[model samples]
Target: MPSKKEIEEVLKLDAEKRFSYTIKRIADFEFVWAIGDQHGFANYGDDNGNVAFAIWPFEAYAALCCKADFANCKPEAIELDFFQEEYLTDFKDRKMRLAIFPLPTDKGILIDIEEFEQRLQKELDEYY
Candidate 1:
């Protein structure tokens, strides 16, 4: 398990290695400013091993939530809750989820990353 600082350090290193891009912190976690897409979410860890932040970008609106992860992951995983979209309205002002899993893998081919990303990009491109 890595401490929050360790995770941040890795993220920083990853960012430094990039040729060009900008990532900033919204509340506690870092995120790359996305122009017109909600392709995926950003997961960030803190110096304390007890907490993490999940970032969601919705049609230019960003929401941040803090969550607890008993399973410390260097690359924070993504997941979907067992509820409907209405459930998200309840967390419009929060930072964490009751559960988190590796995203895209939650559903079948239609809802997987490959498909979902395509839809997101097509939608986001319209804004470009």
Candidate 2:
């Protein structure tokens, strides 16, 4: 799991090119995560109920790169289906569900940045 500081650094590096897409751990699953954007404020789950990992500028760019498969990734041309139905589904038999809202945003995990980071870190630590 990436630490808050690490995430912050990554976000900082990606600042100029804001990564509006978000990837979050699926609720009720141990190793399921999803990738999506913040549109319509759709609720993937209860606010602050599930743990969201990262919000990247490129779709599945972080997940693929984190898996050390950077050579095969083309973020600019990546699609959600490329990740959801193909890659992420292998982790679990069901579909990959992603929340529509960004972290620390209203209607989903209403909290400050520090608290959000702390909660994510805590959940990750406990999971490991």
Candidate 3:
């Protein structure tokens, strides 16, 4: 696990760097984090009304985002296999976008499922 300083530095990175870092981390860890309770997972919306399913590479990152609309949610981990086989397929079927590693101050990177898949694949290739 990353220290507080490392996590803070990652959080301060630009959206593209943050997204790439998250992808690399997730590939290395073989899991991903999301904030949610019994109802459903947390989501983010843009001014244009575009909605995205928010995700993170670490529990600390997801836990830090538990505010505002997601105050009641808790950090939950999804194994990489389930994320790739189930969540990604479902999100793509619903035409949902991804908000990777969103912070309270930053909405993070909003990417469609196909692009996210491609990027994640690239990271996994390098990880192996």
Candidate 4:
């Protein structure tokens, strides 16, 4: 695992580009996830992992939560009201409907890169 400082540095770089980061705890581990607009697509992933591009912010957030332990995640839902109608319409037209509805956001939800890294470091300390 990367040190907290390294993770924070990576997240900072992403944030400098206006991307948001999320930290999720799995079975007994935590992973950093990020989403932001870059090169015409909304990218999502960690420093050295698979990335899902060309997706919406909410979509990326939802996908990350799905792979994590929901009980330990934040408590925010992704209501349609959170997004603009035009964006939804465009996504629908492109056949990229959201698989998870009412995305969650709270303590363990997708947060800023700094927060994500901080929380991740805390979780890692507890785990180890």
Candidate 5:
């Protein structure tokens, strides 16, 4: 397994522009990391009463791996609303729609952005 520093280093790649449209972080609870400062990902209900997208770990991590806005993605259909409300960004080109979620084991797991992309695409093809 990669050390925390090594993993952190790898997860720090810039992966915006890869996905169409812009994203920025929001002032919401989903943005908060799980216990131990470890973050999770999953869309939750918003004031608008819609299911939004939520990326786990962090945005840069999501970008580096080629994952789409967790909410914008759906195998059922390529509908943006299927994901989160609006994506988040720390800076220009360094865009993302990430979130911090809770892990069942209470252990944070760094997500595979690439794998998330693949699975999402498959979901698009198979379901959507």
Candidate 6:
């Protein structure tokens, strides 16, 4: 668990840094956090019809967004391998985007699924 100050510091980072942080941390931990309820996982949709599935590198970080649109949801951890194999394929098929490290106030980084996958893959590849 991250301390309050650490969570605050991470949240204070700019969107780009937050995105990079999410990628690196998820790669390091082999899991990502997302908010969901009994119905299904939470997501944001815009007028343009692009749905964004938000993820966080830490459970504490993900807990911060459980208000407003996600008030009924709770943070759930998804393994990196399952995310890469199952969710990515479904996301690509649906043309969904990824919202990296979203906060209560900020929307974090909105990235295309394929591009986000590529970035994560690169991080994984560099370690092996």
Q: Which candidate is the best by TM-score?
A: 3
Better of 4 and 5 by TM-score: 4
lDDT of 2 at 68: 31
lDDT by residue for model 1 over 1-128, one digit each (tens)?
33557444433443222111111221122222211123333443333432222323221222122223312222322222211233333433343331121122221011222333344345445555
Q: Candidate 4 on 59-105: residue-level lDDT in tens? A: 33434444343433332223323332444455545534222112223
Models 1 onward score TM values of 0.23, 0.22, 0.95, 0.25, 0.25, 0.94
Which pairs, if any, clash in model 4?
74-108, 76-104, 76-105, 77-103, 78-102, 78-103
Clashing pairs in 6: none
Q: lDDT by residue for model 3 over 24-128, one digit each (tens)?
A: 999999999999988988778888898899999999999998988888999999999999999999998888899998889998989999998898898889867
Q: Scored by CA lDDT, what does every candidate get?
A: 0.27, 0.35, 0.90, 0.34, 0.31, 0.89
User: In model 6, which regions exceed 4 Å deviation?
Assistant: none
Flag the better candidate by lDDT, 3 or 5: 3
| lDDT, model 5 | 0.31
Candidate 3 vs. true structure, TM-score:
0.95
Q: Which portions of model 5 show Cα errors greater than 4 Å?
A: 1-101
Q: What lDDT does model 2 reach?
A: 0.35
Cα lDDT, model 3, residue 22: 92
Residue 55 shift from truth in candidate 6, angstroms:
0.5
Clashing pairs in 2: 19-56, 19-57, 48-109
Q: Give the lDDT of residue 21 in candidate 4.
A: 32
| Candidate 1 vs candidate 6, TM-score winner | 6
Backbone clashes in candidate 5 total: 18
Error of 5 at 51 (Å): 22
Predicted model with the maximum lDDT: 3
